[model samples]
Target chain A: MELFTLIDILWMIFFLSLMIGCGVLFYRLGRRSESDFFLAGRGLPWWLPAASVYATHTATDTPMWVTGVIYRYGMRGIWYTFFSAWCAISAFVSTRIFRRSLAYTQAEWQSLRFGGLGSELLRGWMAGWQIFMNMFILGWVGMAMGKLCNYAFGWPLWIGLMGFSCACAVYVLAAGYWGVVVADFQQGIIALAVIIITSVWGIIAAGGPGAIVSKLALMGESWRVNPFAFTGIFGGEFPFAWFITMMVISIIGGFGMGTSIDWYVEAQRIQSAKTVRDASYSIWAGTALVLVRNSLWAVAILGFYVMFPNIPSQAEYELGWFRIGFEYLPVGMVGFFFAAVLAIHLSTISTHLNLGAMYATRDIYHHYINPRASERRLVWVGRISTAILLLGSFVYGLMMEEITKWLIFALWIMAAGVWLPNILQVMWWRFNAWGYLSSWIANLGLSWLVVWVLPAFGLIPDLPDYLQFWALMVLGALIYVPVTFLTPPEKMDRLVKYYVMSRPLGWWGPVRKEAEWRGLLHMKGED
Target chain B: MAWIRRHWTPEEADEWQKEDWIAIILSTFSYIALTIGVALSLLMLAVGFIVLILGIGLSVLLFFVIDPKLKAVSSGYEKKQKEYLEGLERVQRWEE
Candidate 1:
């Protein structure tokens, strides 16, 4: 692996210091209140946090993952991110609703949606799972960065990854989400620059884009340029029917995302906005930026195939991005590329650290340990939680060899069970806590049987990701539908308040009618 | 048809949103322009300097031109959820 020169080292130092400077600035500007740190005191302008959202989504593994997909399935591989785009679709409509929900974290939402012991149980359960999910994501991405640094600069993996994790934790602890959002805005700009430049540079290195196309053509690939070209149209890895089915499911998931009471992970931005309109605008704006990001990475991957057609180790093709970064980029640009990587990693990791900490401090501490904790104490607890998450994720990262291997299982299979409940929670009135709880439990147990054990042991035939996703989504709906109908409906008063606030379009006709009768609504009824 | 309007207070109706046309036109064009620009830039990558300069220009436009327009167009959804929170707090107080 190539090493960083003194200039490269200096540039990296400058990059880190700029981030620290942001932390200092935010700390000074912030009022030291919990709301200011966690949600920018609810006064952020639209574009700032919009850019921050886009920046946070641009993770270290994103480019590497895109490159690997393109290499395997051609440029049409971008269709994979369509799953997340559904969230954007829902967020566009739901921004006002999510912001209006006034939930500090998703867990705190249960009490607002349901009543009594059931709401408490649901709140606590959701909190624990959400924290676990966040920690797992942090570890997976941390390991990717660790492996990347080790390869690029030969720094000890633990030192580079764990060391940087500490820096991010400190940055976050300094000013909370203010630092996270500010640093994210700065990082977003640099990261975008590096992505575009490196993409252009890589294509140039590969004898220009036209020549790269010619080389790829000679390699006899048909659908690298056209995104619509699915090999599944014929007998390929992905079938057309399966693609359509998953898309339908994702469209449904979009409704769930839009309707779901909590989005605490991204809720800070939603809450931080000066107006609901701005928060909504932020979602679409961030999506456009994301499109630009994906395009840059796609071009780089397309160029990579032509330049290094026959790297010895085919299995390690995911690291093909390293070849482009080290071999193709000029001296200073290479350093900038590394800085850009750190920028993306920092943006994503910091969000998880801050978000996870907020969930833990608010849900775990405030609910269980100290019901009347002071704001100052809560802020300190938030810091401690962030530090603890960083340490736990670092240890988890050390244990993993490759994050890519687990991703398919994690996103589709492991998380798929929640996909339906997450969707149903917003739309259906009858989905009680027991129904909600059973859906997840059934989903977990079903996924293990359908996607993992049976397929692995050859009891059942192995299926592709789309098939597994479709199966679990259908099975999850079936379980939850029955469970919801069988379980008692949520109390009328609780449901009526939820309907008026969130005002989502779904099976909340009864609640809306009641809200109307009670004179709770200020204007005409909405779906 | 918009949910915001359905629940809008009489006071809120007086608040006319000015031409969101800038955010509308700019974002649409930027999405298309940026996409087409990157495609052409990659094709024109043999002449790397040209694309790099174009890219720098586009990034500048992104921050300066596109961002402010979008920010100006809308900012109305802030209090939609607050009423719910207050209502829920009242319920809790009554239960206590």
Candidate 2:
């Protein structure tokens, strides 16, 4: 193991110690109640939680991946910004509904609205999938951290993986939700600062925006205009249909996946807000933060391309960002940049750990293993479960070497398995528990089957991975709709009360007599 | 009710403004401009592999000179934004 420079080593130690200190401080501060541990006592100001949510979601992989997308597709990656914009707006609109209901989890809402074995079954399955999705996300965080450590300190992948994961586990287990929130706020600021500095520096390094555009124009109009260009397996060499399919899958399927319960940190923040208006404002504020934060990273990646015209291929995009940071950044700025990277890794990893532990302790253990368990015992379980999940993630990180592709695959799986069923059940009351179960199983099963069987059968085209993902998603959704309708609808009363509260637009059943008698009738065309 | 409506406090106005779609729109546009400028630059450089391959020697020399200037300009804008927001806060305090 080659020893790092004194400057590098000291910088690393400083960040590591700071992270550990923050974790310890948060742990002591939040050890009072399960509510404090899990939800930060539900008293965090909108800005803090909103910032935390943005920071937690803005992973280190994001900039690098965005860079890769810009490198490969040019202008086409801009579409993703639009999609995210829509998702943000949608999230903002949904916050009012979520705030009014005041359910702890999306699954709880399902249960309250639609009681019986079906609701229970749906809740159990959704909870299980959430854990699985979180595990996958945690793995990606570990892998990204490992790559950064390898780049910065020449640490072995396993060492970096363990060091990062363990630190996150310690902080999250100790501080609980409060630690994650506070750390997220701090990290979010650091990440934003670093992104601004790096992107500006990168753009200047590349000879300014005008020069960069000129260079792109020279490469080929396709490179400048076509998003699908350079998207195929081996460059711009893939078939057209493949690219089309990938675009559809990533953009459209992404919307459904965005609505998943685990992905709703904004909703969590909104729900935790002090009042309805505060919650709504928090969502908008959070949306703004995400937009700004993501844009900053996007700029840096774009600037790097301009600076280093011979950008790394798509597979190496994430590593390329780190490489650029290491090679191009000024001497003192390197420390700051590395600090931001560490912040990104810690903020995301700790949030995942906290969330995963919530799933295990509240959704699983509290509900299934020991409903009568004391708050103290449940908190202990949360901490232990967080540590266990971190360890598992570290191990998974070791198994996986690449960060970007791993994240995309994990996201695809989540979109198909978790997001699809959960959204359908929530929005479409006609969707029964059996339908939910079957849809989830079929989606995952089909996605896996496509991955395994298509190549063997030569049915898989030499298209972009995104296209393949899109095709699979369409296939999966098509399969799900039929399966959903085939199954019986959930009984009325279990979900009727939720309908009354949420007033979600759809055919939910005849309005309750109580609603009619109390002059709460929605009217004929109210829906 | 008339007095409340006519002599509405500035704090109330600011609160209402936070909810205004106009603020969100302006913020979103600002975000978009920033994203486009950065994303386009990277896309150009990454896809312009042929130029890079041909002028590797020249590009290397050019990059060292260019990168720092970009950082300076970009950081300047950020600093301005920070100052502007701080100024707004001060003005609000003075008004109160």
Candidate 3:
């Protein structure tokens, strides 16, 4: 274990105090009302939420995940980290529509978009799933910190997992999203600054970029620098077909809400923006930073590879970015780097803590259990829920190693079969609640069979992940399409009201015509 | 008419048009260019500089084309947000 000097310890104490102080500072504003607590009174400028977005997604595991891919596949591995591009079209399309709807969460959006029992069912299912998903994310990310601490100081995994998360929960429980977002702004700036400094330091340590490039050429590994160095068309490790599938999933997926798992976190940011314009720009700008940061990390990982040359294990190589920071930085600065790592960990933890509580308090408690609840009572419930999620995450974190595979399967099911339906629900007027619900149900069974059961029994060959995505998509459509046609379309009046409010893009022709006919919306020329 | 519509009425902006399409296309291109360009540029490659410049240019064009339309839409929506919020509450209470 590396010894941290007194200066390093003091640095950690100072940053920790500053983060907790944000909770105390924002407590009054958060206590004022449910809106103030969860959404910063929905009055933030674009940059506030933008910073939160950048901070929230830059979790402790992010650099490791990025390092693993870049080290294994060279610069071409950047595509693996490109999934956040779902924000590209979403910034213009779904962000606009959802902002106009003024729904508190995607679960609430379901009720606004569809009517009757199916909408209610969808709302409850989504809220429960989101709450579970956020907790699961908290567990895994916390465990990542646990592992990192174990690597750095020989601390037990649980101590790192439980300690930092509890500290972050201070702000989340006290001031809700108000505390979370404000702290995130400071954390985001620190994380970005340190990331640039350490990465450049790493590049310099490996004899600078010029020497690194020349050395790679000498080693006959020059293709590692080429971003488009595909091994073959469809058969090799890095294939063109895989690239095409990734592009489609990343870009086209943006047309739908909840297409990427990141969308749910971003939905909160979208609603918190002061205007629809602010919301759109926040998502767009925030994701642009994410992409740029990934690229920075990519080059730094290349620097690490050139120096190490032949690391055999995935786990060891994945720690390359951290090693650069911990091993190379000046003595006093090591503490500062550790503080930045805490900032990254806290930013993610605070987001999930507040996010999971939102589902619990707003969608579950207030909507279903106590619609007549006071603002004070609701805020209290939010705090209580935050505490519950934190405690539950500890349990989830401890058991994470045993269940990592199953949870990953759960995440894949969320993305693959439901991806097209997610878009259709936003873009198509006749895509009823039943259709969407059935797709989720169909995908669960289909994903398990295709990914595990069938492969285990040797009924079918185990396919690559991209191929599994296609197979699930096609199989899911067969079930949901018939159910949609078999069931009646959503009520016209409801569709008309939704169209007048949201003005969503795509095959919304019939809804638009009905809205115009009812005089709820005017024709372009008439207006 | 200008190739890109800069000024939009709230009513006109509510409709999806070529401007929105242009913004989407440019935005996607910018993401691709910037991601690839920044990495290579950091390595001091000449081609990286060209791609990075293209990404910046595309981003600027995207913002100009879409910002006015978005502003119009936002102003219109803000006026109605109060009413929509009430509707949201009713749905939550199962009173609609």
Best by lDDT: 3
lDDT of 1 by residue, A54-123 (tens): 8888887877787777777666675554444443445444454566666667666666766777777877
Order by DockQ, highest first: 3, 1, 2
Model 3 has an lDDT value of 0.93
TM-scores, all candidates, are 0.85, 0.75, 0.99
Q: Which stretches of candidate 2 lie over 4 Å from their true place?
A: A1-16, A80-83, A218-267, A311-317, A402-410, A417-422, A449-455, A458-488, A509-514, A517-527, B1-96
What is the per-residue lDDT of model 2 for residues A4-72, given as tens digits with 9 covering 90 to 100? 345755776787787668767877666887667877766666687777767876787776666665555
Which candidate, 1 or 3, would have the higher TM-score against the true structure? 3
lDDT of 2 at A279: 59
TM-score of model number 2, chain B: 0.28
Alpha-carbon RMSD to native, per candidate: 5.6, 12.2, 1.1
Candidate lDDT (C-alpha), each: 0.68, 0.59, 0.93
lDDT (10s digit) by residue, model 3, range A1-527? 35589999999899999988976699889988888878888888999999999999999999999999999999999999999998889999999998888888899888889888899899899999999999999999999999999999999999999999999998888899999999999999989999999999999998888887888899899999999999888888999889999999999999999999999999999999999999999999999999999999999999999999889999999999999999999998888999999999999999999999999988999899999888999999999999999998999999999999889989999999999999999999999999999999999999999999999999999998889999999999999999999999999999999889998888988888888788888876783
Which pairs, if any, clash in model 1?
A: A100-B81, A276-B77, A276-B78, A277-B77
TM-score of 2: 0.75
